[model samples]
Target: MQSNPGSPHSDLTLAARPGAARQARRHVARVLPGWGMAGLADTAELLASELVTNAVRATAALVAAAPGEDRPPVVPPDRLGTIRLRLSRPGGRLRIEVWDADGRPPVPRAADADAEGGRGLLLVAALSAGWGWHPARDGGKVVWCEPAGP
Candidate 1:
């Protein structure tokens, strides 16, 4: 993890796996108060989880679909995916950016009351002032969102 001095910002790189979301929540919880942004912690953590979860899912899917010998080697040579989480409170808005190794952009599903999943982006939209994603020039994409009302 890397943090900027004199700023409420940090960059966390984690293995894109099943438990990454939980780790992200812990990091957010640890940083928010010191940044003087505790009020946004709950919602920020939720959004961070959703984004990281989606990223891990996408990376796992990609690895599973790749050819046996074409799969990218993970840090441990078996994990096969990576995610970078950037947390920043810039201009009075808490921005959560999750970068995954997959380039597919997330689409918000319809408001379905019966769906158990596929509602991550929907939750992000509802809880955030704005949300969107863009493909990274190097690879993959970055999904970002910010809390509502400062």
Candidate 2:
């Protein structure tokens, strides 16, 4: 796990792609043990995957909607945005923050039981103590959540 220099948080910046969610989960698995919260690692990793998956989908949509104009591309031609996963401890609770270059906040949709998708935020709301989002000063947004217990 790579710790961010000059900061108490550890972060992983991933390309806004399908693979990023897996990478984010792996990162959480590696970092949380050192923070002495190994017991919470499974829950944390699950929540992180859900959040990162949503962020990646949102970012891809944003890039597709706007091919040009100010939204910096993470790579040439593809116009992919960056997804940042940050881990921090505040007030003795683990804070999971996923930053993406999409201004739209996540909305939990009521998916049918047979639906194959759209349950990300539902899992988040169930597993997380609290979750919400706010627009970033530089544009885009950060979706954050904290698990219910130790």
The C-alpha RMSD of each candidate to the native structure, in angstroms, is: 3.5, 3.8
**Candidate 1: minimum summed lDDT over ten consecutive residues — where?**
71-80
CA lDDT, candidate 2, residue 4: 39
lDDT of 1 by residue, 1-150 (tens): 865445678989999888999999999888888787888888999999999999998887777774774543333334346899999877867899998876777877785688788989989999999999998766778899997854
- Stretches off by above 4 angstroms in model 1 are 68-80
In model 2, how large is the Cα lDDT of residue 143?
Answer: 94
lDDT of 2 by residue, 12-91 (tens): 98988899989998988888777777888899999999999999998877767655655543333433468889999887
Q: What is the lDDT of candidate 2?
A: 0.83
Can you give the lDDT of residue 31 in candidate 1?
A: 80
- Candidate with maximal TM-score: 2
Candidate 2: lDDT of 77?
41
